[model samples]
Target: MKNSLKLLLSSALLLTLAACQGQDVATLNLEGGDNIVGGSKVSSWSDLSKHVLSILTGPGERIQICTAVLIRDNIALTAAHCVYQKNKIRIAYGVDLYEQGNEIPVDKVVIHELYGGPGSGRNDLALIRIAGNLPRKYKPVALPSVADTPYQGQELITVGYGRTGWMKGAENDGRLRQVAVNVDSTDMNKIWIGRSNGKGICQGDSGGPTFLKKNGEYYPIGIASYILMMSDDPAKKCLEGGVLMNVVSYLPWIHQNLPSLN
Candidate 1:
């Protein structure tokens, strides 16, 4: 609903891997089949249910357009691009947006100091503080430890309230979704994830979470950033792979800003 065409086109130019040489591969077009290309609808509540949040932009007739992850009862983490242009934002939790959920107003949005926007994808992280504490159902997710290491071929799960398919365009629909992707590579600030068995990130998934499991618990390792279109066909939508901002690399910055967490 926020007119993804502009964002998609702008991101297309930023996909070149050469620009990101030292950090990671330059951006490439996304390509794939179905499932998010292959993701499935989340059926019921789970540990991930409370930590994943839907971000709604605009006033009055707000719509779920992006995703965020809760790191505290009143704090959430998302991509810098998701909150950079707005003064106020709203986030929702629960199974369905229209049916059952809580829409919390965000009072403060803090974007990373180094974030350079669509072109560079540098420091593409943000933190949002809700005006008040949420109910117990909205639980905080753990951040990855600084010592945690990411390797190629590692399997990771990504969760969001984004589009199920690209042909129909972006839709909130109020349902949460999950997809599994494999880490293709990693750098100091970002991780590249490729669709595993057809599952990948879509248009509305920006600012979502890419989780890694440890000790039977899931920790957020990356923040959904951008997707690459795999095909040259202008008609194709949300085709192939995507990128996530590595959370572990920014722990010190996060701790500095969100002092309460310390």
Candidate 2:
């Protein structure tokens, strides 16, 4: 069951901890097709915390959960595959989803125009705007500028709500987790972070933010898109590099869609 569940979606399977409406964790399908992602659990909403939130997208029984970062008071950014279904989607605010937090209503979800539809992960980026103001703690994180480029050997910090162990369902606990991965390479479309000392991403981790620190503050440069699988074994599947949709490359499109962001 574990082997079958982990390889359900695309040939490459994009990534998302997508599950049924009531299930704790679903099989791997789209981006961040999570399994046991290695990272430290975040217990407090301080420093670079809280800026990240979970997205719950329901289109039929399939409920896709992905991580998104608040870029504006009411606007958040994530990978296109996360909210592509665009059904009854909502954003959950808090370090832990099952905890005492509110599932905020989303007013809008705009996927990138260039995004290839289902199974085509090209230009996988999107924006989500909620209906009201969020708590002050969930402040918006800064977006990278068009001119900005990730320096060589940049240490990127990634955050996700994905599973923490081989059998530990990422969304089963709904707690946020993080890891710092070094840049293996980057291109106009994506940033690639190789598996670090055996640590990488898994389900429930899609659309999460990859931050580049500058002047002591973290700036979002990319969002989770897919993981390069090296093995068919579920435990070793996510042991390769992780790919992120470069947020910096989509600045123009984002500005055009969300004019207020400009």
* Best-fitting candidate, scored by TM-score: 2
Clashes of each: 18, 14
Candidate 2: minimum summed lDDT over ten consecutive residues — where? Answer: 4-13
TM accuracy, model 1:
0.80
Query: Which residue runs of candidate 1 sit more than 4 Å off their true CA positions?
Result: 1-36, 60-64, 169-172, 234-236, 260-262
Residue-level lDDT tens digits of model 1 in 1-262 = 2234224322422332223224333453121101244666766567788788877665432322568888877888988877765664677666554455566777788888888875457788889888776777778888889777678998888887655655534443556788788999999998988754557776667788889988878899988887765565423435567888899898888888897433
Alpha carbon deviation, residue 63, candidate 2 (Å):
2.6
CA shift of 187, model 2, Å: 1.3
TM-score, predicted candidate 2 vs. hidden true structure: 0.82
lDDT of 2 by residue, 199-252 (tens): 666666788888887887778987887776555556554566777788888888
- Candidate 2 off by > 4 Å: 1-36, 59-61, 166-171, 260-262
| Candidate models: Cα lDDT each | 0.68, 0.68
lDDT of 1: 0.68
